[model samples]
Target: MTAARRAGGPILVGLPAWVYLPAALGGLFVITPLLAILLRIDWANFVPLITSESSRAALIL
Candidate 1:
């Protein structure tokens, strides 16, 4: 067995602070667009909008 495995400890203890900045930016990049879409939703008419014929066709496609 490897020395690390023999020690019975985690292989990766922690990450550097610099690593977190890019990780956070990547997460925000992906989530921001979805959040913007959700924010712009007309909640009161949401069901009708999704149930519309055009929407159903698009979903089927």
Candidate 2:
């Protein structure tokens, strides 16, 4: 028992496939909106658009 304690543990725990399934689904749920906004952005003008006065005011509000 002392040797096992020094070695870290006697019992090992593992995540189930069901746990991974929910985690994957939750990740997709959270990422979808971010991906949508990324897709809608104009990459070439992104910096200018984000820094414009109107955009800044909207964000501040």
Candidate 3:
């Protein structure tokens, strides 16, 4: 047996490739839309946009 596998020694295990793929894709899935919204933000209209009637009504609720 390998030294790592011997009694009281540290044992190591390998993870499957498939495990990481979903996690990576999920991270991208969540971040992509938020990034898109941030990218589309109009700095010039930032204040007026958020202060509009609809925006105020939405915030009040």
Candidate 4:
């Protein structure tokens, strides 16, 4: 939300902040694999998971 605003995108216009949920979830999905790789976990055992920040943000609502 903050970065989009800085990049000149609209901030919560016709749609409420709810519109960002899917995008945020997609972000989590993308980041999960990257973090697991950085941690050097065995590829075969890796299970992509949402980051703690994403979980907290979702719960706060």
Best by TM-score: 1
| lDDT of candidate 1 over 12-45, digit per residue (tens) | 4456668889999999999999999999999999
Every model's TM-score: 0.74, 0.68, 0.61, 0.39
**Local distance difference test scores for all models:** 0.86, 0.84, 0.88, 0.68
Query: How would the candidate models be sorted by lDDT, starting from the highest?
Result: 3, 1, 2, 4
Model 3 lDDT tens row, 2-61: 224657777866677688899999999999999999999998999999999999999999
Per-prediction tally of clashes = 0, 0, 0, 0
Native-referenced Cα lDDT, model 1: 0.86
Candidate 3 clashes: the total is 0
TM-score, candidate number 4: 0.39
**Tens-place lDDT digits, model 2, residues 2-22:** 122336557655665578788
Clashing pairs in 2: none
Give all candidate RMSDs, comma-separated. 4.4, 5.0, 4.2, 15.9
What is the Cα root-mean-square deviation between model 2 and the actual structure? Answer: 5.0
